[model samples]
Target: MTASWTVSQMPDCTDKTVLITGANSGLGFEATKAFASNGATVIMACRSTERGRRAAIEIRDSIADTGATLNVRQCDLASLESIDAFTTGVERDYDRIDILCNNAGVMAIPRQETEDGFEKQLGVNHLGHFALTGKLLDLLLENDSPSRIVTHSSGAHEMGEIDFDDLHRERSYGKWEAYGQSKLANLLFAYELQRRLEAANVTDTLSVACHPGYAATNLQYRGPEEAGSRLRLGLMKAINAIVGQSAAKGSLPLLYAATARDVQGGDYYGPDGVGNMRGGPEQQSSSEASYDRQAAAKLWERSEELTGTTFTFVLD
Candidate 1:
């Protein structure tokens, strides 16, 4: 792994179409800029078209023209209907997608249900992206060159479990616990997707997972602000100022996973700093549970049932 890997090291991506969810702010926004600047056509899939348009304008004005096209499309991952509509539109307009970054996610927030009646964090973070990836799998496989699906996870996954008995936390819910479980689910889904891709002999498609480490992003404030806890929000802001890295630095792992030539199908990338919390991108092992094939398979089956979207791949 290159210890000094930066976005500038990204390979020429002209004509490659990269789709990123939650591209209006934080890591997703930074990644959008990086991919566009490197000559990739970027699609900003935001929940709010207004916010997505604003972000697109900001990128167009801020980034030097690189012949990269930036398009903002409406996509609310919290709703399966919205995901379907967004993907349908994407399929209508584009025949191939070179990269899909499942970067949109909800952090530790108060217990709430999505439009689909699932826990908010799990729904938006894991299941939503799961459905999105499954729906877009064909577009990814259509490209002649290798295409990648980069799912953003976190260090919180280390403390998580499947909790199959209480998958939705309907019986009980803790903010951070649910967040950890969702992130762990991200890893499980990512690894499982890679395995399925391999079994199906799809050599040109890769499913990789990554983490931004402890980057100061609006993600931290969403939970506190949602719960109306000013104290918690303030504390999060302080922590971000003191301990978190810049969003640009934090997004390196995602860029690496998306564009790095050396990346394998199931590789996981994160920060190289102590505790995997900050610094440049580096390949690293995920938690032991993330490698549980049985758990991953079970989660995948349940996800298909919940989302009503089945992956098109036929596994051996």
Candidate 2:
């Protein structure tokens, strides 16, 4: 039987603890609110402490009756040092992490390299999350019941092609192409992680991927120099108005993937509307390339090498 992807149907998460990267705004912010309202302890892992505090306050105010607590911590996904600090802090405080939402990301930014010399988009969107998840694997495994890791992907992954030689985009770069590649990496990592989990007999944890179906979020406006031309900014706003759904609505698929009882490992989800661009939640298939096991395996190796992190769960 097919499962319904509605937030209203989400199982009660009163005792659950969720950590969402990039919880300062947009879909992450809405998701923070959703989980907090359900009585989960929400950790907002953001790059900016100021913004993170504001977001946590806003969420707390919105869900006062639930008595859920929001913790704000600083973590720059583009930097390995920051990732380590964030994980260490979490380890010092929390004993178990029930849900990890790898949702922080940068999109369509100008060609740039992170401090580690990796491309900005790939570093923040994939490798950083890869390292973070690896560091926190012990805490996730400590949970006796099913724990979840939801990696946020995008429909743009359909246009992505992983170029191993130019993974850093040093030779050539286009904003959208690099963004798509990073998003594709997110899905590939999710699937590959699930494979490794099952092979290692780690039945208590699940890894899943999800997309927010053209949500009206700050992710749409980010760029190299913030779109200097009014015409360009106007054009983007026009496109968003024409196609985007509200952030809350767009977060349903992710919420479903993270919390739905019947969801399986490696399931990909998106909106259930025209072109899968803007609507309610539903299970959706990704590109044929995304399902290539060989590519996924290679990507997994490259990710481990790049991030210098390895999973305890070995892939067969």
Candidate 3:
């Protein structure tokens, strides 16, 4: 595929089932619309079922007669119990999942703890998806053909370091630092997952990571809105207008990773623009730290201990 790959280049997704977290808005929502328009059964796993339903209605109204099947289910990544409920429902209703997008995340908000007491950014962005994937592993593995798990990370991961001594940031916390840690954790998990699957000889499943470089989305405004700082919000709007790409454009890397036939596990995709910020999706290398196998192993063990969910695979 060319570096300028677009959704039009995607394979026909008919008869496929895709589960996208945070599907009510941003990249996930755009992905939902794209996949559904191509005749796939799209599950919108959202934190708010009400918002999810409204988003579904909007997609249906806009796309008129694409034979899209969309289902909205509630899944709050900040809460382990909510993920449990969502995954359980999915397991009961769907026998196989062709794609799973671990896309929902919280950005640089004021430091807070999740329902399970993890740092908010690390909790929602990394650990939450980890637990959800473990719980739904059976459905993904059930696919006769290869299934894809596309994780959404960010370029900010380059600035991150896994503070093993203080994973929850109870000692100190800067919002951006926490966000970076979470994003870096995403890559580590994606790569490690692929390694584990390969070690177990599980060829029918692929794990990949992608990022929407500097995409303009609600995520930009969320932190300022949460902080009730209009100044920060206004600055973000200005930055978005001048420097950011459209969410639809930013979402292409994820769409490419999810559906591209040539995609391989452990691959990372991002925009091909200057500094990897804004352009068509292309295969790219993540930070050197993201490939640290030792860090990945430690994080994996800590995550399982914290989330009480362990992924089991018989390794050779």
Q: Over the full model, what C-alpha lDDT does candidate 1 score relative to the true structure?
A: 0.94
Between prediction 2 and prediction 3, the one with superior lDDT is 3
User: Candidates sorted by lDDT, descending order?
Assistant: 1, 3, 2
lDDT tens digits, residue span 86-188, model 2? 9999999999999999998999988888889889999999999999999999889888678999999999999998999899889899999999999999999
State the lDDT of candidate 1 residue by residue for 196-224, as single tens digits. Answer: 99998899999999999999999999999
Q: What is the lDDT of residue 147 in candidate 2?
A: 97
List TM-score per model, in order: 0.98, 0.96, 0.98
- Where is the poorest 10-residue window by lDDT in model 2? 1-10
TM-score of candidate 2 on Cα atoms, chains taken together: 0.96
Please give the distance, in angstroms, between residue 138's alpha carbon in candidate 2 and its true position after superposition: 0.9
TM-score of the candidate numbered 1? 0.98
Candidate 3 residue lDDT tens string, 128-206? 9999999998889887888999999999999999999999999999999999999999999999999999998999899
How much lDDT does each candidate structure score?
0.94, 0.89, 0.94
Cα RMSDs of all predictions? 1.4, 2.1, 1.4
Q: Itemize residue pairs with steric clashes in candidate 1.
A: none
Clashes of each: 0, 0, 0
Q: Which 10-residue window in model 1 sums to the lowest lDDT? A: 307-316
